[model samples]
Target: MTSSPLPSGHDVVVLGGGVAGCVLAARLSEDPRRSVCLVEAGPDYGPGQQGWPASLLNARALPRDDVWERHTAFYRIRARVLGGSSCVNGAWNTWGSNADHAEWTRAGGERWSAPALEPYRRRAVDRMRLRAAPDEELSAWASAALEAAGELGYPEVDMGAPGAPGRGRPLLNAVDGVRFNAALAYLDAQVRARPNLTVLSGALVDRLVVHGGRVRGVRVILDGRPSTLVADTHVLACGTYGSPAVLLRSGIGPEAHLRLNGIRCEVDLPGVGANLSDQPGVFVPRSPTPELDAALAAGEAAGNLYVSRMLVRAAGEYCPDGAWNLHLLPTAGPPLFGKLAPGRYEAGISAFLMKPVSRGHVRLRSADPCEPPVIEPAFLTDPDGRDAAVLRSGLRKAQQLADALAELAGPSDPVPAHTLSDADLRARVGTYWHPVGTCAMGPADEPGSVTDGQGAVYGVRGLRVADASVLPTVPAANTQLPVLAVAEMLADTLRA
Candidate 1:
């Protein structure tokens, strides 16, 4: 985005234009007096309009980013568009559960509870204009998957219907074949028309300009030129990865680690990039049957059948009383709108291992803001072996579902759970990309918490975090709606 003549100084500055960042910025700028500046590391395509890349705007397909890498073979897919992962992800509105909120309340007080945050989730859904994909919209594969779920004793119900737990249709954040992301839903033309908000896309925030134990401004790199955008209050809404990396780069992390990374430690908060967690998932795919292929071909001709159905449940020992701990996303049709093959027919069940106890970390490779941070999301590395156990059960469940499909389609095949041992399952684990808890929240006395109940970074002044990085643990479901709720709560608490 071209630099405008907006004032350099502002009352509030929100960094990162992701889901939480977009909503937080838009919500905070409603004062009509608070001069808010939003900084993003990606391109701003204005709103949903033509000439924008079809890869990013296509709701039925997931776009890939070459820049988002990790320390392992598993790819970390994060969108670089203004709406962040909300733009690229399978725009499902799974609000998690009350048990999930109980954990949040335990870590960040009662305000983070589900009862307190349910209104925000509703408001967020209303703003995003989410709707449940109708049962008729289910593809042939999805229909058979649902049938298999019923055969396996799983309930056929709406996955996000509050306390009801079972497999059913998923609520999607899309409208008319387009993704209703945070940028379009919250920060649209009407919201951006407000004079108090100045959004600067393609601007990289290098570090926080901390002076006298308070953030004065941010050292930003815009269009390859360095500049500083001064503000009284600075909020880091840069999701799980970018948020903590910004803190570490600003010398607000573990002293020795920051020093080892060739940076001076301004604050010895050890939890800046610690306590990272993510949902590990795997895909068990099957070759499509002739009937499934024919049905898909018909849908392909008509541009219909965007099936986003799922099975949310507590498969094994992590079973809670009223909530699910795992998600089995069984989908049909081409992956990424024909990115895999021209007309290849396939079906896959994405098994998500939620309620994971494994924790990870994000370390800065160097002080350069452009250099990607060394992300170490140690998936399935739980010491208690519970994570692997849960994943094994979920994979077995997915294999059973796949087996049901194979039986209906006339090809009996074995997936990883049927063929490989539990030890093998450990080697081939991948994330659902729902990374959270890098900058966890807790009391100051605790060792791993970087923020308090109010998202105030411990020992910092006029600075706070308003993103998924502040979550104490990864929620039991998709992180989009939960992360948006976190931002809404922060916006309600943060001063003007």
Candidate 2:
């Protein structure tokens, strides 16, 4: 809603001012010598939480406002605001197992290892002010879920770091029911006061001006006018969906696809918009007992009602030993989408298939920057049927937890989830909203590898990608914390 004249250029231009973008901008701009410009497609909301909308500031529920597309496919839903998905996510932060780090280390060498990234992870945790769920914040359902996991003989493990798979509460970025987004955490008043940092919001990136195997400049539509912002370095932090789309539009994607879209191919990278991976889950609803409903209503009235506060990190049949592939989340509160009757609420156990093998893609419909890219999650579509089988295993585990809480809630589904047909499972599947691997990191010779271990694009000089888009594989946990740590690590790489 506000407009300002664009500076001619900067030392570094961080595109997409989301979670990673904010962190990159904040860290890269720490040195007064480096002039860093952060461009976001959505509103900046200025400094602090006061200017943010009420829905975005509340951690009790995932806000639909400030998102890219409302009422769209759940998997396609992404935040368009400055803080990115953190502005609209569950505010829960969890870490992955050593196996996740092993997979990353394979693609990106030792830098992607657990021990190597630990320092940056700690920095992100402290900066974001992540804290464990307090006892007072847990509702009766969440409390029971934890008890049930222990009753089922699962050991308690820390959810915010690398450890064996088990049951525990995740670290939250919210405190006292208020969501602390990345913009608030990283782009604080002190960071914004830096004259070297320029945040340009409501600017939609059209394409990169690539020439001679290097980024010459970037064209963005700001204040209804098209302008070019030049920089010595261009960092793509536009996230999984937006990052790949920007590459394709810039004629840096698959040559065949670029030709079809009538865009001149500057780079023939085959992996630009491919290898999309995301976590998908199915919610098994339950009928809450009257007493449970009354208790939840009380929590709601007191403004302490949280949909979910705990989860079980369970290993699937195909999972490697000492690692988990499923998250059994038990939730009971106001429905995420629709409203329930006055005192009634929605209670369910959701089985999320973490680390899914099924890969999807993002493709440009045309060269138009305004046109939303075609996103195919391709959930449960692995050829070997491994993804679907793992999901079924998770569903059975969720049913076990639900059974443990039978006194508080009863099964509302006519049939158990594990027993459901493949078609039925596909129909009921929803995403964890953790999409990654569009501009994946790996060896340059690999077919689908877009970036190297250090996030430098295969053939592009003066360009790098520092976001979830570069993650070669999805970790077996929520992506918020991992992404923050990743951006921190990449910022260090840039600084060095």
Candidate 3:
């Protein structure tokens, strides 16, 4: 691999041009004196590329779009584009609560607690437009589910207004009505126009160049051309799969696993790719109101109106470090009550069961960079059974909510005509696309940990990972905001 030297060894070379990489690069490059480079394996967005709505529907319809299509014991989807998964995912905007970070500090370390996260949260909010649902308007169908949940005695949260009847404001991470991608939000005209900042697409990074436990450069195969790029500080924002795999190819990862694959072990870090977790979620389909059915029949975006009226309700003290988010997204598809035809008009009440106690791991299948990694989610792997138990309970809660709404509106039967026994639910329960924690950040006291809270790789200078992969556990909400938050934090740390 041969190529030109960098204008000068960069201050930071961020791998992966996804949300985390983009945000970190943009923020780090804010000072004109510093240089940042973002490299992505996929093509950048263009007028020729499909729009957000089309991408969402395609993934929803084609099983291939879902990560579960891999059939590799774990379910995960990696976007091979400039914007990464955010470019093609359901453009739902949400943020993490103090409760979310507090749980991380508890499970991982105090450095990650809600208190430690306050400054990052402030910066994240400052970078975007945030709105909270009003008191009166918050009592919608989703809220009714939270109330019913409280009546059932599962933990809930009431931030302020009232205790018994839990209430929450729906926070969206949007700028105007358009979606807010880190690449878009962080890369203003100033950053985009910088000559020092090089955003390269189609640059497939094969491995990191490590010498004496420090990263010296990156190996890449760009557009079928062999090349090498050197940098002062290398950031592995390539994400969970890409980052860990790169490590393995470069003779890093678990000792035993590397030997089996005929590769020398450079870093005997067992936790290089372990403790994988994803929030369990099953679609709770809802039969549409007649008016809604008619609108959908006319080919309109059916569930959007209901989503606009959504609210999250909870009770009890916020877990701080436990499950803290309850997002109520309205999806138009087969009813949660039962399966429906393509012509059917329905909605899905998608919920993210954050604070999963379950954990899994990622391993290299072979030495080939073109081959995908072997992923074992070890879903429901926790001995406590807390994750599975909550999801089972949520399924029942969704059924109840559907029934209550059906009774009020009269839909023959609110539940799907298909009978989903407890057995079926247990068999079908899966994830809501929030996969994290393969490479976790923790204090030295924690075994098998990979990086520090600042995202710097332990024992390895000039190398860092800034993405969902660093999370020790999946949060109880969408990962978009948290990923962005960490990227921003990494930027500040790099600057300091």
| Maximum-TM-score candidate | 2
Model 1 C-alpha lDDT versus the unseen true structure = 0.79
Candidate 1 segments exceeding 4 Å error: 1-3, 65-74, 335-343, 410-419
Give one digit per residue, the lDDT tens place, for model 2 in 1-496.
1136687579999999999999999999999999999999999887888888999999987888798888888898999999999999999999998999999999999999999999989999999999999998999999999999999988999999989878899999999999999999999889998988889899999999999999999999988889999999999999999999999999999999999999999999999989999999999999999999999999999989999999999999888899999999999998877788899999989999998999999999999998999999999999998898999999999999999999999999889999998888999999999999999999877999999988999999999999999998999999999999999999999999
lDDT of 1 by residue, 1-496 (tens): 1237534878988989999889888898889878898888888878555636776666777666513553334445566668899878878777677787888888899899877887887887788887887665677777777777888888766554466467776678876567677888777778888888888988887999776678877888887988888887899988888999999999999999999989888889989888988998776767776777788878777777674555546555577776777788877777633355556666677678888898889999999999888888888787888888788788777776777777535433444653566577766667777899988998889998899988999988989998999998888778888888778888999852
Local distance difference test values of all predictions, in order: 0.79, 0.93, 0.61
212: Cα error in model 2, Å: 1.4
Highest lDDT: which candidate? 2
1-496 per-residue lDDT for model 3 (tens digits):
0112333367778888887887787777778887777787876553222333444333223223423124444356667766666665544445555555665776556656666655776676566444443333222344554454455444444332112223244444433234454555565556678766877767888888788888888888786876777888888887766778887777777889999878877677777888787766566655566655554444334322233324343211224433343443434534434566655556545444556677777888887777788877666557865655555555554555555555322344455422455456546666666788887877766786887787777777888888888887665556766777777777777889
Q: At residue 208, what lDDT does model 1 achieve?
A: 91
**Candidate 1: worst-modelled 10 consecutive residues by lDDT:** 66-75
The residue ranges of model 2 lying beyond 4 angstroms of the native Cα positions read 1-3
lDDT against true structure, model 2: 0.93
TM-score per candidate, in order? 0.94, 0.99, 0.80
What is the model-wide C-alpha lDDT for candidate 3? 0.61
